[model samples]
Target: MRYWPIPLLLVALFSAQGANAEPIGFVKTLQGGNAVIRALDDSERPAAIGGELNVGDTIRTDRRASLGLTLKDDTIMSVGPDTELTLEEYLFEPARGDLKLGSRLGRGTLQYVSGSIARLQPDAVSVKTPTGTIGVRGTQFVVRVGR
Candidate 1:
């Protein structure tokens, strides 16, 4: 009976850890087919409208599938069919002037729009592909990575 409190404490600790895994963005739109999201430490799941996405998550869209996402800083991203993109890193705290965004697109196409993070610190945003990295300068751009 004395050990009962121990399990409760453990559960609380685990729950707190899970709570710290904040959502970095959400699925704003989708078309053609379903998109899948693989969390940093979780299995793949269907990305539905309004579904939350966290840092380190990988979003994959199959043929004829597309996805649109809006991040915490209002940065907009659209993934075209057969695309693989990862939210490698992100930190947005305007008050503290701490803003950073980094992502990698392995294949397919991506459309990006600048947001508060880019407006706050233009040099803090980067999108990488097999060839090289693209530095965002408070602008909108599209990229396609060939398979």
Candidate 2:
């Protein structure tokens, strides 16, 4: 047998799977059905318990809404009412020494609880806001942006 066809087949398979790759996180809890997820493509969808979350997703909550979520690295976070946040980056591959989690909160409140990445590499986790970036060094922390 020849190896010529293997590369083409592998490329085809990976390209097909790329669009439906696993989510980075999910909506573990939601309140008042007021949270919406705006994708990088600008498509919006209502947030639901267990809803899958992806990188570049802008999570927004109305004045009466709040929600909680968990990432692939076991990181937990919750957002308060009128929140607008973006999941900017994430990479969890401990065996190969790749671990990072980053986000940007434009407004409202954010409560973040560090995960294995912080324990392994404290400098890998951060939450950026209008004022400054919160370098996650502890187990838990909270931040409030604009309002």
Candidate 3:
């Protein structure tokens, strides 16, 4: 007799969850168990294959660790050991023609492969480092940052 309340409650719950729990990408490859994911609040978790990644998340790899991530728009990114890369922003909506990907590499090496976002809107993708910023133009590239 209370079916109406159940439906309304479910909608509210799912809406609230999706607003903040939507994962932007996932961890695809992990060479070692020394990788960590740091949240905006500074909390960290061990990086593992299939782990969810969100915007503003920082991925850190120890001396023996490496990680690979695949974004929602099929963009691929891999980082070598001792790397600190943060996903500064991500917005992908091809139908509406709104796409962007921004990342920051603090140190170490990173390999990036362009995705639909870069292909459709080449000017929307960028990678920032300590010394400079890189604009993606539907291609793959590697960058290293040193202290």
User: In each prediction, how many residue pairs overlap at the backbone (N, C-alpha, C within less than 3 A)?
Assistant: 0, 0, 0
Q: After superposition, how far is residue 145 of candidate 1 from its true place, in Å?
A: 0.2
Residue pairs with backbone overlap in model 1:
none
TM-score of 1: 0.85
Off by over 4 Å in 1: 1-20
Candidate numbers sorted by lDDT from highest down: 3, 1, 2
lDDT of each: 0.89, 0.87, 0.90
For model 3, residues 78-106, the per-residue Cα lDDT tens digits are 99999999999898868768788999999
- Worst lDDT 10-window in candidate 3: 13-22
In candidate 1, residue 107 scores what lDDT?
Answer: 98
Predicted structure with the largest lDDT when compared to the true one: 3
Q: Name the top TM-score candidate.
A: 3
Expressed as tens digits, the lDDT of each residue in 23-132 for candidate 2 is 77889999864989999999999999989898899999999999999998889999999999899888877887988888999999999888888889999989998888
User: Between the candidate structures 1 and 3, which one is better when assessed by TM-score?
Assistant: 3
- Give per-model CA RMSD: 6.2, 6.0, 4.5
* Tens digit of per-residue lDDT, candidate 1, span 1-147: 355686456656764675435577889999998789998887899989989888999999989999999998999999999999999989987776878999999999999998988998999999999999999986799999997
TM-score of 3: 0.86
Counting only residues 3 or more apart in sequence or on different chains, how many pairs clash (N, Cα, C under 3 Å) in candidate 3? Answer: 0
